[model samples]
Target: MRTLSPFHYIVFSPVLFLDKKQNSYYKKINNSVGNDAGSFAPLSFYNNQPAALPVPWDTMLQKGRDSVLARATNNSMGINNEYYNAHIKGKNGRIKAVDFEHNTELKDFRMLMKLIRAYEVDAYFVMQPLNPHYYTNLKDLNPVIDEVRKEIKGGRGERAYDCADFFVTDTARYDKALLTDVMHFSEYGWHLVNRAVMNHYALK
Candidate 1:
């Protein structure tokens, strides 16, 4: 559930988390830059559903914000600038925040930059394209994501966009129409996702 080194945190990613000690998992992604590969398959939106399993983020964020606020109030209380400063220099330095709303279950390039700048651990992020409807609804997520990116880049820098078939908007097709579950995607949908991942990273 938790690791002692690197940072004390959690990451729910669509990609595989590698095995290693001192953040090898984080650095392994750098391999993607070599050629351009992708994930084995598109992570099914079905993965986002609640099958008595880990709660989905969008759902959990909305459902638990109040509780999180309450808990923060109980613990952190007010801004202890002194305490915050110390943690930022020490504990926070070891943190790596990874988001999973995009195609590969990671944040956009901009968010990647911000997270990298905020801490000292190995940092990376991937942007997964969403279906038209969900992408339109969740597009606003880009702003927050960009904010994180800005934090990492500091001034400005270039970013790479995913070239995979992330959006499954062809309603004419019978396969996609089956994914009407609202949150999770169907099997065919994930196929395209996996394809895109492999293409992007140039994976074998």
Candidate 2:
């Protein structure tokens, strides 16, 4: 089997900076599963396989496994259906506003950039858009965004794309149709993001 190593190009998003807690949780899940789990669990299933799976059976099994794993991890992290549902409904109860000046996440982000540069990798950091409804202090976030841009440029010497800026000068920022929830973009919003990225890179 091929081991997963660092790649040539990496696209990071503000989601990394925003949800720092998720990183620790992912580590916990990895530790809980242990190194032998993947090898041993699949071995048992391999010996009992039928000639062929029924139509959609493999897909269903994969989905079921994923759902169960996700649920287990979320439960371990103290996230329940109510919390998830509130986030989906554009609630900001758990969303932490970025503290651009003194946020510790920036230190980690800068370290990441340094590591990526050491490997001579082309790295792109994307500042994702947030649902306007989710933040009552939208005006306060502008400085935070500016600080983020400055920090990335100072540390990586590479300009990061602030996808949120594309909407700032337009009426689109207020359009709820552009977002699926508190932090995710809808299809049209993603189309705009793709266009913006292509244009920035001068891609044909």
Candidate 3:
């Protein structure tokens, strides 16, 4: 229900963001979306240094992306060992595959569903744009997202009562080269997302 990203929004549109700041487009969405609507986590990708907050969102999502990357790099050598069955601390300190990287914290997508259920959300969507293409991309990660949805859905008992009832979608399946990194989209990526969002909203 929530997305944590290290991208800075300003990199995308200074004029739009500045206009949003003045007109409060984000605030309007925030006010309309209730607890059921879920939230965006600390989107540091939109701000930094002085690190002002991005508009229309509350709560930081994940730790700094750099910090996660650094930790993962340290474990890169260990990855080969795990692949070879020479695992270091296999069962002892297993980080879930839910994470984007080893250093990334395990975000319980199920827990998010629980909150959305509590809020009585009718529809839910989570958007995770490509981070680093070398790390993971939407086209290849659909199955993992599906698994997370199943786990978050829980069972059809009381737990099911806590799941988002109507619908939930995670849309990240875009092309690989669409991003230079998290925030700056490649020209094609930008056009793709632009068309996608417009189509989503029937904008043209």
Candidate 4:
């Protein structure tokens, strides 16, 4: 599973191994811009500002949700926009259910936990909520989530929040208006997620 990439060694090797004296390339780039300005600000002149729009941001978001809802209602359970359309489709164009087994081999998750512990970083993990429109049953998802929750409980203690049922539990948020597609959420769903995060990490 070790995929090699030349970009990692070529880009990050100089910064990791060489000091300021040896690596002047980064230092020169850093010093090129003033204290108040960004180094790459000049390079991004064309795409710096947001395009002028007719409607307000809130209206734009509502329009986006409306579009998604229209598409979801017109299509078959939003499968046309869903990424699992081709992957999960079986004979007679019926969506097949998958069986998930408990897996404890979370090597990357352990490595990440070690890194956060070493750096003394306050990290929080959120198991993003799923749209029931895509997955009506949680029987298959439970085992995988159980394993992940076990790892997080053993590693990060209470720093993880399982919001996998956030949308499904509430019938109000379980609509296509809250979802951009089958997998991803819309602005409204993200706002709910933001509230959940704020509530979980609120100052004591």
Q: Give the distance in Å from residue 2's predicted Cα in candidate 1 to where it truly belongs.
A: 29
lDDT of 4 by residue, 26-60 (tens): 44566676543333233322235566433254665
Residue-wise lDDT of candidate 3 within 2-38, one digit each (tens)? Answer: 3333212211210111322333455556657763334
Off by over 4 Å in 1: 1-113, 116-155, 158-175, 178-180
RMSD of each: 18.4, 15.9, 16.1, 11.0
- Clashing pairs in model 4? none
lDDT tens digits, residue span 35-67, model 2 = 543443222212454665233434544554444
What is the lDDT for 16 in model 2? 27
Q: Which stretches of model 3 miss by more than 4 angstroms? A: 1-108, 122-133, 136-146, 151-174, 182-184, 201-204
* C-alpha local distance difference test of each model: 0.34, 0.44, 0.35, 0.44
- The pairs that clash in candidate 2 are none
Highest lDDT among the candidates is held by which one? 2
List, residue by residue over 38-132, the lDDT tens digit for candidate 1. Answer: 43222332334454543244454343333333322212222123433533222311112234453242334435444434444232333333223
Order of candidate numbers by lDDT, starting with the best: 2, 4, 3, 1
Which segments of candidate 2 are over 4 A away from where they belong? 1-11, 14-95, 98-102, 117-120, 155-173, 202-204
